[model samples]
Structures are given as structure tokens and as C-alpha cells.
Target: MAAREYGQYCGVTQALELVGERWALLIVRDLLVGPRRYGELAEGLPRIPSNILAARLKELQAAGILRRAPRSRVVVYELTPYGRELEPVVLALGAWGFKAMGDPRDEQVVTPDSMTMALRTAFRPAVAAELPATSYAARLGAAELLVRVDGARLDVSRGDGPVDLSFAAGPGIRRLISGELAPDRAISTGVVEVLHGRGDLLARFATTFHLAA
Candidate 1:
């Protein structure tokens, strides 16, 4: 568990003590997506040292923030009900951190879980409420996602299906989501490549999932 104890008794202090270690909240972040087998988590977090991942998992399990359970005869790790409450906190943190995300480094690679959460963080329910339903199949680096927005609800999943727009982009898609780049410009500049479906919906997709600066 806890790396160290803060002498002061406070809610924030307690919260940090519970999940302050590096990669702890990230474990929670992935589990928030859904249950993941140990190998799945390892694959998603490529940089995490095997021992560190195991240690964090044990710490989180000890804190009751997550648990291991059987799924299709394989054990998977999932957040506990108590841990699910961190969704909003994680989203808020992601938004705050996004302001400092100038660009991705050469070593940084986007994972499906991270991309899913990023889309969730940028999703604009109010704006989407006024737009028609749309679906987008986006491939960012090695991540592929099926994003559907109906009214104010957004559903994101791995893999592909029938979609209004299917495109591929690297990390530059952040510019699109953050409203820094217009859809036409993104397409024209190769920031996004339309593989299938209507390219016009990219504008709608931009409107639906946006984060101001």
C-alpha cells in the first residue's frame, strides 16, 4: 500500500494516501472501462514494469478499490463499486491535465483504454444533445474505436462497425478534439484520413467531442 503516512488527518490526504503511488490511479482508470485480465492490463500499459504492475494491483486490491473475479473462466480485475466513484474525479483530472498536453513524445503511444477515457473526457453532452446521431470509427495509432453519439449519450467501444466516418490519425486528433483544427483542415492536412463513410460527419464528430483549449 500506502507509500507513506501523512500525520494530518484530512480527506484529500487520505485519498492520496490510498492511491497516490505512481500508476495506481492509472490502474483504476483502465478498470473504469471494464474488467481486464492481468495480461490485458499489461498490454494496455506497455511501459509499466511487470513487478510494479503486480505491486500496484496488490495495493489496490488491498485497499478494496478493485477486485479479481472470474470472467469466462479467466480471472479479470475490475473496480469495486466504491472505486467506480472515481470516474468523475478521473475525468476532471484528465481535463485539467489536457491543458498541459502540448504534444505526445516519440515514446508515448495511445492505448484503447486511454483513448476511450480521453473521448469520454472531451465529450460534450450539451452540444451533442442538439446534433443528430452519428457514429465514427477512429484509428489512432494502434487504437481502433467505434464511437456513437445519440442525442446526449455517447457510447465508445473497441473495434469497428458501420459508421458514418472512419478515419485514421495519430496524436494529432487531439487538435481536432480540442477544437484547434477544423475538420476540413484536418482532412486536407493529413491529420486525419477518411477510410470509409461520409467525411462530412467529421464536423459533427468534432462538435460532439470537444474540449476548449
Candidate 2:
């Protein structure tokens, strides 16, 4: 699986050689959230060619980054302990790229897994440590997420649950996350719709999940 050799005896070169193939790190990103069946991965990455997905999966498995294992009697792909070490790297990279993300393209669609990772990337544990615990039921594009911030810990998952705030946002939500739009301005400007909770909590949400531009 070391097909993309750089002829350099360096760790960064080796790392890229293992996962530099297009769509490889994305597969790792999705699995970092949780185990996913093959079909689930396909669903998350709608644009990935089927053959490419299969080939990358095989390559990653060969690299010992991920493994297929039984989950509820069905096989699912999950990152190994070694692969789990990539979490911080992925999150840091996401934060770095986020600074340059001005707006979404016409064809770009947010997936649950991607949204989950985005939340994780922008989470401010130190800020949340000073704020009261809060839970949010957030709908971003087509992704529905339950986000809970308890002091310094943040938890996110799919589906709805008891939440202190519920809101829906579109791609413009990035403006709020980037602190370009204030919470009050976001709600008043129709960038965010308060569905079923105190709108004030949206301010808390903004503070807790923020990535400075």
C-alpha cells in the first residue's frame, strides 16, 4: 500500500504515502465519528466513485488504519487504535482549512458525519468551561445533530433528544460559527431559525461552538 512513495526516509513523507490518495483521509474522518457499514460510507461520500471507495478502503486496511469488524452481526468499517490517533490531526487540519472557507460551493452538501466533525473542530472547551451546561438540537442543511456541552466536555450525535435549544441553519451558519455574524444578527437576518427553545441559548451555542476567523 506504499504506492505513493516519495523516496524520502521521513515520517511526514511516510504519512502522506499511506493516506495521500484522494478521498482516503475523508474515509478516515467519517470513521473517526463511529463505525460505518460500507453503504453508510457510500452515503456519506455521495461523490466518491464506488471503485475509488473500495480501493481506498482496501488500501487503508492494508495500512492498518482501519479494519472491518462485526457490529450488531453485520460488518462495519472502523478505525483501529492506531488510526484513532489521527483525530487531533484531522481536527487541527479542519480548523486550518476552515479559515480559508469563505462560502459553500453550489454542489457542496453537508453530511451528518462532516457536520459532526465540524462541530468537534470548532468546539471551545475552555469557553464552555465557564458557561452553563447546554444542549442543542441543530439542523444544518440536511444534517440533524444533538450537541451537548457540559462544562469542558462536548458530545455530539445524530438524531434528536431532550435539548435546551433547537435551531435550524443553512450554509450561512458558517458566518455565525466564524464570528462574522453576531447571534442576534444571525437570528434577525434569517440565517438561523429558532425552532423550539429559548432563542437566547443560540448565543451560548455561538460562544461554545466557534472558530475564530
Candidate 3:
């Protein structure tokens, strides 16, 4: 009951047999952003045909990559606790691809790029080393954003109280941690803007974390 493939030595190959089909990984990636309804997932993943997307969601549900939950009597696909466990795996894959391309000086992760996934991957023990007991705020256009620290989680979209800082980098929240855009330059160009927080605190916080490219 090991689920081992008789002739497969590569673990990835065997795993792929279960989830390596077309657009399957993308489904998993979208789920990592947050819980989304079937229609929402389809909207986010426009390249996927509706019929294929539906099929893949069903397959993922069966394989435990996603779980179906009742949302207003309609089934919605959500990442299970087990499925959330794959965030690191997908992030690592994205970072590997970025580095493998051999262009460190450029912003490898761009808009419509999976920067959120990269940030999710990069926000680990090493990067958050000495994480001070402080919160961060990002002032996105027309939306006040706050990321409060809850142990290992960077709780997003709290949108509560006075924002400590602001990041106005379009929709690509993932680029900040993906190492494609410099935190400083991005600020200068208005892609990111810090409205509050002590400079010293911000500097220290910046040093303690990094976006995995």
C-alpha cells in the first residue's frame, strides 16, 4: 500500500502519474492564493477551458489536492490542510525555474506571474530569521492592507486600523518576495510605497526577509 509504481524510480514521475496532467498544477497554484469558488477559479485561470477545469477540479478533489466544501449549497473547491501542505513544493518549483533561467539581474517574476506563490514559498524560517514581533501594512490602491503576524503565517488582507506601510505594486504581491523587484527601487518608481513605519524598523524587517526568486 505504498502506492509505489513498479518501474518508477523518480518520485516526481510517480507523483506526476497522479497529478502531472495538463493544468493540474495551475489549479493547485490558484488554490494556494486563498479559497475560491469554482467560477472564481475559472475566472482566475482563464487559459483553462471550463470543461477541462471542471474535470481537473474533480480529479484533484479525489486525489486530496482539493476538497469540496458546501458554499451556499454549491460545492466549492478549497485546499485541504493536506493540500495547503503542497504550497512549499509549488513555490520551490517556481523558484527553481526562475534561477535555472540564469538571469538574476532581471525581474524574473512579473505581473500575471506567480509571484504570490513565490512569496508564499520564500516566507519560511530562513528568510524570516529573527522576525521581530511587529506587524506590516501595505497600502494598495484604494485598499488598505495589513499583514499581521500569527506565528508562521503572514495573515493577509486584514484591512484593519491604521496601515503601517504601503506597497503599491499593481496586483503582483508575489514579486516583492520573489526577488525580481528590489524593495528600494520599487518604492522609488512608485511600484511600492511605504506610507508609515519607522525606517529603522522597516530596514530591519527588510533584512530579515526575502522573496525566493
Best by TM-score: 2
How many residue-pair clashes does candidate 1 contain?
0
**Residue-by-residue lDDT tens digits, candidate 1, 55-122:** 99998999999999998889999999999999999999999999889888888888999999999999
Candidate 1: what lDDT? 0.91
Judged by TM-score relative to the true structure, which candidate is superior, 2 or 3?
Answer: 2
Q: Point to the candidate with the largest lDDT.
A: 2
Measured against the true structure, the TM-scores of the candidates, in listed sequence, are 0.96, 0.97, 0.69
Q: Assess each prediction's global lDDT (C-alpha) against the native.
A: 0.91, 0.94, 0.62
lDDT of 2 at 161: 84
Evaluated against the true structure, the overall lDDT of model 2 is 0.94
List candidate 1 stretches off by more than 4 Å.
Answer: 1-3
Q: Give model 2's TM-score versus the native structure.
A: 0.97
Residues 123-197 of candidate 3: C-alpha lDDT, one tens digit per residue: 565545446555666543333445554455665553466545544445433354455666665566665666666
